[model samples]
Target: MSLSSKVRTLKELPLYLPRRFSAAQRQRNRRNAARPPAQGIVVGLLAQVCGRLVKAGEEALRIPERLPPSAQRVQEELKSRGYPHRVVETEETTRSAEEAARAVGCGVGQIVKSLVFRGRDSGRPILILASGANRVDVAKIGKLAGEPVEKPDAKFVREHTGFAIGGVPPVGHPERLQTYIDEDLMRYGEVWAAGGTPNHVFRLAPNELADMTGGKVAVTK
Candidate 1:
């Protein structure tokens, strides 16, 4: 099937993945992706939220077949959401903000990192969309959520969000984790987010993206 025709829901990821992934890791990720989606309302209900707002014209980021699981997952999620995307694969994983920006030829500030944190009291997760140039002040973010927010461990991220660290998208979590968008991201005309995977990213307009995710935009130091 063509890339466009093959993808359905966020669950249909195998159709887009490459045939040769590291045997051990590939098997593990496939299992995780196939599991039933955990019960939780997709926070925002805007139509074509990802595609309509994040991708535009010739600037769309392509999803490569050999991308890391996180990047691959992001591509499929965006595609499922109706966004046109292309995955840019790299020889090595772009696990950090600097590497992701370098791979896409953008400034560190333009990279939009999809971060997950656990609220101390509510036990609900918080997804923070912050600019690469900025750091998420845990105290400030925690205050916004009306609780102390702590970053969940890798196991917690996967268990709660379904997707692992590098691949978590801004939306599509098991629960509608309280979300925040840094005002700094809006300063750029375009921002890049993990395609659901670390190796891939999709460009988005900050304002429209905030609308799509239903995240309150705030200042983060």
Candidate 2:
């Protein structure tokens, strides 16, 4: 795809990436483009370069020809909820925050790292949509949740969310949990979340994410 079209495929990403962050990347690309042949990087292609945000998500990301069962279910849920961005897959699994961010070509902070913790006493699931850049402090989460919370295992995650860890989207759980969003994630205009598989992800506005999950904004430790 041409560069602009490649960017377009990411939908709202180009417009919603942090302005200061995008500007800095463009400046660097301009400087790199002016370097002489001795620099060994091709000036023509380099000149067209934007930020990693421009090239990364579309280049590294893939649109699966066929969706798996879990992926298909997540797709249906997103459609049912009117989420504009659809799932994009990757050649490699985005099992970690770093991997997802790099694959999506956005800041690590823009990735919604979905986490599941069970109430220590209630035996209920609690979902935390934290920024990839911040670690959710379990103790603080417990305080915010008004109950002590502890991490759930893979089995619990699948049973509760209807998907495996690393691939759980912010919504589509069989049961609605008490959900919370990281204030840090709310700082951004757009954010990416898991698409029901380690290799899948999708983007959405933070507020819309909150609504979809019926989540409250919080510091998320």
lDDT of each: 0.54, 0.62
Residue 135 deviation, candidate 1, in Å? 2.5
Task: Give a tens-digit lDDT track for model 2, residues 95-199.
Answer: 765454445444454455677788899989888776555666778888988898877777887798788766777777899978877787666655666777887
* Candidate 1 C-alpha error for residue 103, in Å: 1.3
- Top lDDT: which candidate number? 2
Top candidate (TM-score): 2
Error of 1 at 211 (Å): 2.4
Candidate 1 accuracy as TM-score:
0.63
Each candidate's TM vs. the true structure?
0.63, 0.74
